[model samples]
Target: MSELVEHVDERDRVLGVVERGEAERQHWPHRIATTICRDRAGRILVLRRSETHSRFPGYYDVMVGGAVDGGESYEEAAARELSEELGVREPVRFMFKFLCREGTSPVWFGVHEAVVTEPLIPDPGEIAWQGWLTEAELCEVVDQRLFVPGGRKALRRYLESGSGSGAGELGAE
Candidate 1:
């Protein structure tokens, strides 16, 4: 059985539950939880999507996340994605949320941050390469590489929010 997602409207009200693929194909708005992981040294954990990934193949992303499952809160989805993608079970600080209109379909993006204290074990199926990069280095890479569009927008918003201040900067956690 395929995964189900909560289909929402422009104001983020749940309309109904739909298959993830159907939601994407039909351009239905849905919720996605994205977590930006940073290590002790204040470096961002970046990863390249596997070549066989469905949405954006072989693209680099600063955030590790996915669609929010039906009946799940954004925070719940973020935590699940963090553990599933990077094998980390840390507390994620909720940053903010916005409707990402740059992608194929509009998605309410719940942006979050987490301090990773353990060794990262990236899932091979979702991530092809993984590394830690300082904010400066990440900026350079984001400019030179082909990044996922929604991720790029999310990073821009995160930086503009003035909360990208290095690691251990958990606010309101």
Candidate 2:
């Protein structure tokens, strides 16, 4: 069976649940929970997506995340994605959310953050290359590499809002 996602409206109201593939194929808005993992020294965790992955294959991403499962809250999904993708089980702090409509489809994206104190055991199916980059290095790579679009936008927003110094405001679409 395919994964399920919570279909949401523009205002982020849950309408119903749908297969993740169908939701994307039909351009239905859904929630994606992304966690920006940071090391104790404050460097961001970055990874290259697996080439065979469904979305944004082989692209570099500064965050690790996925679709929000049906009936799951953003925080729940954030923690789940962190553990699933990076093999870390750290507590995630709610950051901010925004409507991202610039990529494959529109998605209500919830951004979270966690300080990873444990070594990562990245999922091979989801991550190809992984590393920790300082904020300055991240800025350089974001411009130098073919980064994931939604993640790029989120990174921009994240930086503009003081690079996770505080809870960011509800961002514009």
Candidate 3:
């Protein structure tokens, strides 16, 4: 059976529910949870998507994220993505929401940040590998376009929003 998720308009008001695949095929605006995590030393956790991923396979990502499941709030989905992809249930603070317009991967994206004390354990199903990078190093990687194009934009927004310094704002979409 196909999982259903809330479908929304550009303003992010729920229009109805639809199957994930159908939503993607139609480019319906759905919700996604994007999260960036850091450790005590303030090194950011960067991950690479699995080669088998349906979208952006084998692409580097500055965040761990996934589609928001049915009935899940953005905050809930952000935390869930962190737990599912990194085995960390740390508190994720929502930064902002944006309508990504890069290409076919359009969606209402919620940016979040979390701090972890435990070691990160990446799920092989979702992530190919994981590593910790300093903020400067992350800038270099982003400049190199090592991450998915949309993901790179999100990361840049997150950084400019001052969320990396423990300040985050919930910007309107």
- Clashes counted in candidate 3 amount to 0
Q: Model 3: which ten-residue window has the lowest total lDDT?
A: 164-173
lDDT of 3 by residue, 14-131 (tens): 9999988898888898888888788888888888889998778888888788888878999999998889888888999988999986645578888888889887888898899888
Residue 49 in model 2: lDDT: 98
* lDDT: worst 10-residue window of model 2: 164-173
TM-score of each: 0.92, 0.93, 0.90
| lDDT of all predictions | 0.87, 0.87, 0.81
TM-score of 2: 0.93
Which sequence of candidate numbers ranks them by lDDT, best first?
2, 1, 3
Which residue runs does candidate 1 get wrong by more than 4 Å?
Answer: 166-173
TM-score of 1: 0.92
Candidate 2 structure quality by residue, lDDT tens digits, 21-127: 88888999999999988998988888999999889899999888999999899999999999988888999988899998877889989998899999899999999
Task: Report the lDDT tens digits of candidate 1 across residue range 82-138.
Answer: 999988899998999888877668899999999999888888999999999887778
